[model samples]
Target: MDNQTKQTVSQIPLLTTKAGPRDGDKWIERMKEEYTSLIKYVEINKKSDNDWFNIESNQMGTRWQGKCWYIYNFKKYEFDFEFDMPITYPETAPEIAIPELENKTEKMYRGGKICLTVHFKPLWARNVPHFGIAHALALGLAPWLAAEVPHLVENNMIKDK
Candidate 1:
């Protein structure tokens, strides 16, 4: 990771509890931690003029949807994204997707699930309960956008709006 990304990851607080939806009350506690960390991440992004996404979870806190954007060559490229927390969330990072980008790039899976770097899963494995949605966005999506958006634009896989 780059210095700026490291700094951004450091800014978002790590989640404390290791609870998933099946844990009942403990899951509630985990949710609180997730929201707090997300709020902090969003604020940091906003303050840095680097805000790139807006996300909200379902009532169960297991499904999330949002819009994410990349500004490349002074053009804004936006896409709607969503993901569902696996029953083993915190143990398994949710696979975030931009459905509209499906088949547009080789970096994505069949359903538009962004293919994380080979380094990502191992990193998440090491962090475990400490990593949350905020970390995923910072480490996963942000870098993917930085690397792929330029290629996508250059190749005409995506267009600026």
Candidate 2:
């Protein structure tokens, strides 16, 4: 067997004493990485008509909330999402919610939590080490909206707002 070098992780300054030493470091790194990815996602897709979306992120203690807007079929749909890094994040997955959209789809819980599909869940699990809220929104919610909302409108599933 070949010997591998150990990678050192720095302690996160923002973490409180309640946060365990090494685990907090990992969580902070993952959070920052995901947040950066989300920003890059918006920048890269800013000009693309079909895939264009805007995001505003706010750091709230350990959680970050993102306000996202996208245009589909010439109509604008806005969403407020909360991204939380649980102690088990990247291993179990992050907690995300869209509290404003209600009675929208079977995939959504009554409390505004999105129930990701089997397809995306596996993909997320495989890439959790690097995946973040941005990935969830871009790869998960974006496509879900593109495919589901049209049907919701056509079949009269969505309520008039």
Candidate 3:
């Protein structure tokens, strides 16, 4: 990631609670933290004119879907993205996908599940409860788009608008 990205991600607070959907009130506490972190992250991006995504979760905060974009050569390449939180949650990072790009790149698996960098699993494991959906977007999807979007555009795998 670039320095700007690192700085941006650092601005978002980390999750402190270790809770999953089955944890009841503890899960609610974790959701509060997740929303707090996500709100702050969105505010930061909007303030910088660098906002790249717009997402909304289910009432349970277990499923999310929205649009995300990358700008390359002044062209905006946008794609729809979605993910579901695993039962293991904070211990298991969510897998995000841009289904529109499913067959367009080798960097993704079937159904457009972006292949996170090798560092992601280890870092997420180490962070445990501290890494939430916001962090996953910052550290996983953001970088994947940064690295792949241009290639997709260049190869005509996707269009820019």
Provide backbone clash counts, one per model.
0, 0, 0
The better candidate by lDDT, 1 or 3, is 1
Give the CA lDDT, 0 to 100, for residue 128 in model 2. 47
lDDT of each: 0.92, 0.55, 0.90
By lDDT: ranked, best first: 1, 3, 2
Worst 10 residues of 3 by lDDT: 115-124
Better model by lDDT, 1 or 2? 1
Question: How do the residues 37-83 of candidate 2 rate in per-residue lDDT, one tens digit apiece?
Answer: 66556554543333444545444335656655556566766667775
- Residues 1-161 of candidate 1: C-alpha lDDT, one tens digit per residue: 99999998998998889999899999999999999999999999999999999999999798999999999988999989999988998899989998998998888997999998586888999999999999999999889989899999899888887
TM-score, model 3 to reference: 0.95
Best by TM-score: 1
The best-first sequence of candidates by TM-score reads 1, 3, 2
Which candidate gets the maximum lDDT versus the true structure?
A: 1
Give candidate 3 misplaced runs (Cα > 4 Å): none
